[model samples]
Target: MESTEPQRYRFTGHERVFHNVSAIEALPEVMALFGYQRAFVVCSRSIRRKTTWIDRLHARLGDLIVGITDEVGEHSPLSNVLIAAKQARDARADVIVSVGGGSVMDMCKAMQLCISENAYDRESLLKLQFVVSGDGTEMLTTSQAPAAIRQIAIPTTLATSEWTPVSTPIDDETRLKARFVVPDGSPEAILYDPALLQQTPVRLLWATGIRGLDHAINTACSSSPHPFASLLAEKAVALYIRHLPNLGDTTATDSFTQCQLATWYTGMGQMSVPHGFSHWMVHIIGPYGDIAHSDAACVLMLAQAKWLEGWVTPQHDRLLAAIGQSDTPFHAILHDLLAGLGMPTTLDDLGLTRAQVEAMIKPALEHPLVTRNNVRPIKTAADLRAVLDLAWRA
Candidate 1:
């Protein structure tokens, strides 16, 4: 008998802009929506070091700004979440405004939850924190449940965290792949500003550009399909295909808009199918491999895409064409593009030795989430081993 399980989902997003806007004017309005008088701005060390945007935001927001928490780091590690939460608590910040990429946004997301609940560890936190009423009820009440944090995201990078309900957090002990926090854990608003992106490192600019592409392509090929999201994903693919090559040559705003649009659309798709093997593998190898999330994500995209070729549908075919390739051998074409973008084309480049690959299989095979969604299911340790072999040899 064929197995039966639910194959569809409803997606919701944060109430905010995912487009280019003037930060000087937008920040205050977002703060007002969350009813926050004092905001604890969270950002990456890199953004803090390089940009005057944060200072300008503080100056612009004036009294609404409580203080700044500039200690956010890469990967939204659990420890850093604790630290930021503590700092936000100490400052008595009424709301959080994150002003960087995925890492910063994710950090604020977690901080909101921790502060609202007065808890630090994820293990101690309540699961299924919010539920949509059958009659369409929203908002979790203090009487009915524990409260979560209110967060606002000002994304400077195109990694699409603003669009996703899932947040990747690093494990302290293993230092490997972390847990995924749910959408209810996300910020209340996401403010997109292209001016903030201008200050990003050239390398990060390219990496996040590819990162946004991965979001689009991965969603296009996800197990669950939606006509609207597929169209948006194709559009995102077209944007990256055109803009990525012109990095050294263009001052294009449209491409970034395309990326932002794609990120927003695909981020919703992710709520349904989310990421597949690539995301799982990245999670498996992240902390353990010392690979950056974007780098790890891009590294596995083509390899996973190659695996996804056999599962191609008309929708997938159209998406492939948007990236300037025919459906036939789509994986090969995608890999070629990834190689040109300076992304790691193989697992070896990610510091995974033969022994480590062998060690990673058990955990990967055990992960029900990623393994189950694969176009070709991964059922055994050997199946994961083969995927690892392909990734290692890439």
Candidate 2:
């Protein structure tokens, strides 16, 4: 029974999106449009060393390339972000061009904050980090200063970090992650080149594709549903169902493009909806156990589906139809899809132990996103532990 209530939605402004085989060729024109004379490149060390894509970008940008910082780490460590920020400042860069995965994009966003607020020291930076209040409300402490520079993201994976207005940087010393949400944190423009995506490792690419799927699933099943967001989520699920299996064929450029589009749709959908326990669990597992973000999602998504079994809304039926499963349970359908992609479906497969799972429960429950934003209320440690246990051997 669909409710006849009138719905409203808000746009996050029109960002220039370029998608083509030659999308990277438009960087100079994009820079001209923004009056950005000096563009700094931020990416992971692996992307810099292993691929010729950076070399081509440098050649194309010519004198506009101010500096290239490849020091970004997995999870966007604060120390690394500060280093990158210092480099960008020294170069006098007017804009940032991030060409890699989620970590690199997130690092650039945090670097923007560090540069804007002059937050150099760890203590000063930590003070600006977001915190959860006693009553489970998220409190952000961004400086009043406006951002001096913005990023033009060219993502190589389906993590969809480029489209989000939030940045999560991990503290190297404490191994705790902090979220920084600011309106200017999102990228100013995005270039989706399927050819560039071919440089990504197959396993990582497919794993991140599942992460995109998780976004669609969580958005579609949100307790506070938005009509437009539901439409995008359904399309995202359908696109993934069609293209994800073809990712192993290295030459499938169209399939890669479709996956990127699927990521974009899911990213937009999740922006207006609430995510559930799977996202929170992935956040904990990534920092605590030193696991990759996408792999963590692959391990926990089915467990979250199991937990939401009876509580899920009718929108979940759309997800089932997308995957060609009419009467099958949502978790079972997801398990089969992940299995077909050769993704890990259990915590054991990800090499997480019961002790580590137990250690995650307390912190996971305390995180603002987990406690305040989840569809299902996570009130006690036991409730979280039960979900973790199901993920352990599911």
For candidate 1, what is the total of clashing residue pairs?
2
lDDT top scorer:
2
The best candidate by TM-score is 2
Q: What is the Å distance of residue 120 in model 2 from its true position?
A: 1.5
lDDT score at residue 180, model 2, on the 0-100 scale? 80
Per-residue lDDT of 22-100 in model 2, one digit per residue for the tens? 6468889888988999999997777789987788889988899999988888899999988888999999999989998
lDDT of each: 0.68, 0.82
Model 2 local distance difference test score: 0.82
TM-score of each: 0.87, 0.94
Measured by TM-score, how close is model 2 to the native structure?
A: 0.94
